[model samples]
Target chain A: MYRLTGVTKRYRRGDETVDALSGVDLVIEGGSQLVIQGPAGGGKTTLLQMLGGLDRPTEGSVELDGTDLARLPEPRLTRIRSESIGFVFRTVNLIPALTALENVETALVPLGLAAAQRRQQAAEALESVGLAEHRDGLPGELSGGQRQRVAVARALVKRPKVLLADEPTGDLDEDARDEVMSLLEGLWRAHGLTFVVVTHDSAIARRAPRLATVRKGRVAVRERGPAR
Target chain B: MFFTYLRRELRCHAKAALAVALGLALGIGLVITVSSVASGMRQAQGRVLQSRYGLGTDLTVTKAATPPTRGSTPTFDFAGQSGSSARGDDLVTVQGSRSLDASVVSAVTGQSGVADAAGGLSLRVVKADRRFTQGQARQGGDATGVINGQHGFGGYGGVTAGQSGGGTAGQGGGSRFDADDYRAYGVDVSRPDIGPLTSARITSGTGFSAAQADGRVAVVDSGYARRNNLAVGRSFTVSGSTFKIIGVAAASADPAAEVYLPLHQAQALANATGKVSTVYVRATDAQHIGTARSAIQKNIPGTDVTTSAELAAAVSGSLTTAANLATNAGRWLSLAALAVAFLAAGLSTSSAVGRRVREFGTLRTLGWSSGRVVRQVMGEALVNALVGGALGIALGLAAAYAVSCVSPTLTAQVADAPGSGGLDQGGKAVGDVLHIALTAPVSAATLAVAVALAVGGGLVAGGCGGWRAARLRPADALRPADALRPAA
Candidate 1:
């Protein structure tokens, strides 16, 4: 579970102080799915970053699983990100130098898994995303959708409690987008994961049981489906 | 993990590795070749000096020769001289005398450092024509010295050669034909005090007995013997005396001594009887050679006293140019080359890190700490250095061998240690001078120094690369530049 109490993020741009997020409060429960929708520069990614323990609030506090993430030291924050958080970006950010399976295996390195176990887990995760035959293919050699699937596999390979995706379908064709949406929903339902997606795609936002529309550094509207 | 990352990185950037390696190899190769040359010259010089000093005799002291004033000493009219003068004229020419005989020898032998002393005459026969034949049966044996221009044993000054005869003719027809000439030295090889001859490595016959006074026995030098077709026991005639050849000995410090005779006989042959010109002294211990040399110089004021070390140094003079280059210019050149290799490696690695920021950020996001990333870069540098050092050593040794093959022997003029005043100038002899031969040996010490240099260069470059990577923040680095706008 994650909680943000009156959280704010401010950055100095030369002579001006800009508020990336201000006076926002939110809570994310275990195994829950949340979608944040906003136009460009609408603080959607910042909100997701704060919830995922990637950044700290300028004031107030961010707590994840009962630990105050805003006050945590860098090392403990890094540990939380490594063991509990997984990320998928719009660019299908699998390392181009590694194969699909090896990219997934990389997330397990910090866990100190044996090489054999790591490989087995990576292969299984790739298979779960329907990329079993393409485990050995490099990101550059795979199609847009396959690369996105590889990214998804990499994220799930760690078996983190929470998964965060930012514009996951931004660069993919409609078919790849559809496949990624289906995979994300299936993983969320089957594995009891806490899923948070930041996107402008209305269809992805519609699929989430809970949705929050952000405007001007603040959440303006919240929606919950029957499933939530 | 470090090694795995290093392997993948090297494969991706092999060009950089090869470029650095090639640069290091060139510098290392030059250093090895020069070091080997200097080492070889030292070894060869050591051998020559050892042979020149001769065995058992640690110091040589010979009296200065008088100007013979052989022709005439010209008086200069200092008030506007008319004659043409050459550059670098000799001022204050010291007069020499054949006075280093009994008294001087006795004086040196009695000095505190002197353990023993032997004196002998060294001179050339003025009229050793063909009449210079075998000695009588009462003497040691027979005398038969070479007598021909073909043998390079021609008459000295204007001495005419005569027909070969049985000494009876020497009492009569002495100047009809031109006879060969021979440089004669008088020494008792059996006496440890008598240097030059005492250390003669006998290739054939034997030496004179200390008790034997027959005086007709001789020791022919190896080179002179080879030229004159003389063997042990062969009789030769010189200065009208026949000596039965005792042993064909290796040449002494001065290679031009073609014939060696008993001290008494040498005194008689040069017709300077009861007089010896040079006295060689032996010290009690090796370390005391210098002490003895100094004492002898002080005891016999006008004598040239040269110790074995000084003799050795004289041969080393031939390699003065090479030694200077190796010691002075060579060090700076090697350092510059190393600096070049290090600078290029650092700059290239820094640039490489700049290009791979996203990759590094990805590693960071995947749980690699900043320290681990720096270690990866450092490990890559160290591995490259090790490989490059190995390659450089191999290439360096090869270059040394190639240099040695092209230049095996180097010749230099031997300026006898300041003292050999009355002794023959060894360099003046035809076909003989101080020869410093070379054989480059790659000592393990040299290899160790080279390897250390290579490693040091690599570490320097690695440090630069690591420093560049240490300042990057993964979150900001991973984000695209267009995503920098203020969030809504």
Candidate 2:
């Protein structure tokens, strides 16, 4: 679970000060899905970064479970990210030099697992993402949808408590985007994770049980009906 | 995983890695070449000194030769000489060196750092072979006729002039003579280890024995012996004394004498019973030669002392110039090249890291510690440096070998004692210019230095790249506007 109270993130662009997030208070229950939607220059990614402990708020506390991530030291925050949180980004940022299986193994590297165990777990993660046959393939050799699936496998390989993804399908076509969203929903239900996704795609936003729209550094929450 | 990533990255950027490696190699090669050539110069200088002073002679003491006075010229008389063929040999001190008391050898031996000393007499032989014939006087105007091969009938004819009509009979008889001259040294037979004989090797027959110090025996130089067709067991007359030839010696490239005789015998022949032309001294400690020379000069007045170092300093020509260049200009050039190479490698590595900002940022986002990132960069740089080290060693070895193969000859003109035409060691004129072949030798120490420089160069380059990688912020992973977009 995550709690944010009066969170504000500011940036200095030359002589001007822009507030990426201002006086935002939000709560997310555990094992639930939340979709954040916003336009360009909005605070959607900033909200997700705060929730994931990737960045600290200027004047608020971001609590994950009972710990305030804003007050945590850098090493502790990195540890939390490694052990309890998983992140996926659009464009599927994979090391071009590594194979698909090796790319997934990077997530488990920080866990201090033995090489054999890391390899076995990475192989299993590839199988779960339906890229088992392409585990030895480089990212450049894989199709767009297959590479995204590899990224999903990498994010979930460590089985963290939460998954934060920014524009997870922003570059995919309709068919590929639907395939990725279905995979995420299945994984969320199966693993019971606190999944927060930042997306501009309405198709993904409409499917969320709870959606938050961010505009001008402020957020308004809405409860949705059954998926339509 | 670390190795896998490092290997893969290096393979991906092979061109950049090769550039850095080649830069380091050139610098290291130049260093090895310069060092080896410099070492060769020093060895050549030592050889030039050894040729003149013999293997173990550390210092030499002598008195400068003085010009002869009006009545001091040597004379040879053949009056009432036996047989129609009369011969005489005159022994005198070498022209360029004066005689010193034989006691100076013992005095030098007693000095500090003087291990052993021996006195040697340098002498010259002026031999005259003449034939006197009685000629028939003509009862005419000149009353002279040529007898045997004489040019003028001067002496014998005049003696008979009083009995002749015109008394011109003395001008009819004359003599024909041939003069032969050669340089000789009188070595102390008891202590033959420190004098002129140390520089030569006996090729046939034995050298002078201690029992022959007072006996009439001689060792003839091979060059002089070859010209005169002389061999061992032959006898040569000097001042009415016949000395038996006991041995034949082949001298060094710069020979010191044509013949060697016992010191006592030489002193008797020269009519200077207790005089020697030179004193050769061997120091107890070679490192303190200057101390020994100073002591000898202070204790013994009016004596000239010369050391190997002093002789080397007097040497000038191509060898000296090459030595100076190797030690000065060559050293600085190698150092400057290395500095530039290190700088280029560092900048190249740092630029490589800059091009990979997105890659490093993703690793940071994946929770890889900054330390791990730095190690990866360092590992790559180290590999490049090691490759460069190996290449540099090969290049240096080849260059040194090439230098040795060519073996360019360098000339060294060693000056003699001040105002003394040359060192009168047996009147051979010791300090003439010599030609020596130059060699480049690469020692193990030079290779060790090259290895150290290679490693140091690697560390410098790695440090530059690693520092940049460590400062990367994970936030750099997200593009501006904080929204993911398709690649252009």
Candidate 3:
């Protein structure tokens, strides 16, 4: 579970101090899915950064499982980010030099797993994403949809408690985006993970059981309709 | 995973890696070539010194030659000889050196740091053989005629007091004179290892035996022996005493003498029974030759002592110039090249890191520690350095080998430079000019230094790139590329 109390994030661009996040409160129960929607630069990605422990809030506290992430030391924060949070960027960002399988294995490296076990787990994760046959292919050799699948495998391979994805299908076409969304919906339900996604797509937002809209660094939560 | 990533990254950026390696290789190759040449120069200089000083002679003691008195020329008088031909010889001490007391050798040997000392008498023998017809008186009239057989103006016998009467000498009465001169060194047979004999290697027969310390046997120099048609078992007369040629010697560079004799016999011929022209001293430690020279000089005042270093300073020629170039300009040039190479490598690495900002940021977001990222960057840099080091070593070895193959001859004038006051201080010219082949030898130590430089260069380049990678923030990857771009 994550609890946010008066969360605020500020950025200094020269002499101007712009507020990327404002004092907004929210709570997210474990094993629940939430989709955040907002305009460009409306603090959508900033809010995701806070939830993933990638960045600290300027004011107030962000508690994950009752531990305040904003106040945690950098090493402890990194450890929590490594062991508890998994992130998927809008860009696939797979290492171009590594094979698809090796790309997925990178996430498990921080977990200190044995090489054989890491390989086994990475293969299984790739199989789950339907990219098991393309395990040895480089990202350049894979198509747009296949590369994103590798990224998804890399994110979920470590089995973190929370999966924070920033514009996961923003660069994909309609078909690929729907395919990725369905894959994420199925994986979330199967893993019982706390899934939070930041996207501009209304279709993706409508399918979430809970929705949060961020504007001017403040969030407004609403109960969502039934799943599509 | 670390290795795989590093390997793949280097392969992806092969051009950049190769550029860095080639730069480092150029620097290391220059260093090796310059140092190896310098080492070869030192070896050549040592050979020049050994020519005159001999193998074990570390210092030499002598007194400056006294100015010759007027009318000191050798005279040949054939008076009261029964035969038609008369032969006579004169032995003179070597020029540019005065005799030292024979005891000076023992005194130098007793000095601190002095291992052994031997005295040698350097002399020159001038042999004159002449034939003359006895003057006969003949009567003639008028114009004064010449008489060529007599000594004192032919006795002016061509004219009489009253009438001009000519006196004609007998037919075939003109005198013929033949002269020969050769250098001879008197060796201390008991301790020949520390004297002039050390400079010559006997090529035929046997050298002096201990029992023959005062014997009438002599060793002849090969060149002089060939000229005189003298061989072992042949006899040569010096100052009316005959000595049997027992051996022939050949010198590597400067032949010390035309003939070598026992000290007692040479002393007897020169009429200086207890005198030596030079005292060659050997030191217990070659490194302490200066100390031994000082001790010998202090023990015997008014005597000049010369060391090998003093002789080297007196040498001048192309060899010295090349040595200077290798030591000064070559070293500085190599160092400058290396500095530039290292700087280029560092800047290139830093630029590579900048281009990979997105990639490094994504790795950070994936929970890779700062240390792990840094290690990956450094691993790639290390591989480049090692490859460059190997290439540099091969280039250096090839360059050195080529130099040896060419073997250009360098001329060195040792210990005979004008205005070198050392000559008067018992430092004799070993050879007026020597031709030594230049060689570049790569020593083990030079290679070791090359390897160390390669490793150090790698570390420097790696540190630059790793610092940039380690400072990246994981959150930066979450923002859009344009969003993170700073406002201009």
A24-135, model 2: which lDDT tens digit per residue? Answer: 9999888888899989778787788788776778889999998999999877877888788888888678888889999899888888999999999999999998999999
How many clashing residue pairs appear in each of the predictions shown? Answer: 22, 7, 0
TM-score of chain B of each: 0.62, 0.71, 0.76
Candidate 3: chain B TM-score against the reference chain B: 0.76
lDDT of 3 by residue, A87-159 (tens): 8888889999899999999998888999999999999999999988999999999988889889999999999
TM-score (C-alpha, index-matched) for candidate 3: 0.81
Estimate TM-scores for all models: 0.69, 0.74, 0.81
Stretches of candidate 3 exceeding 4 Å from the true structure: A71-74, A225-228, B55-92, B105-300, B303-307, B416-431, B476-488
Give per-residue CA lDDT, model 2, range B291-399, as digits (tens): 8999999999878888866767776779989988998999999999999989998999899888887777667777777788888889888888888888888888888
Q: What are the clashing pairs of model 3?
A: none
Best by TM-score: 3
Model number 2 iRMSD: 5.9
lDDT of 3: 0.80
Model 3 sits at a Cα RMSD from the real structure of 5.9
**Candidate 1 Cα errors over 4 Å, as ranges:** A5-17, A39-60, A70-73, A212-221, A226-228, B1-4, B37-225, B228-319, B408-410, B422-439, B481-488
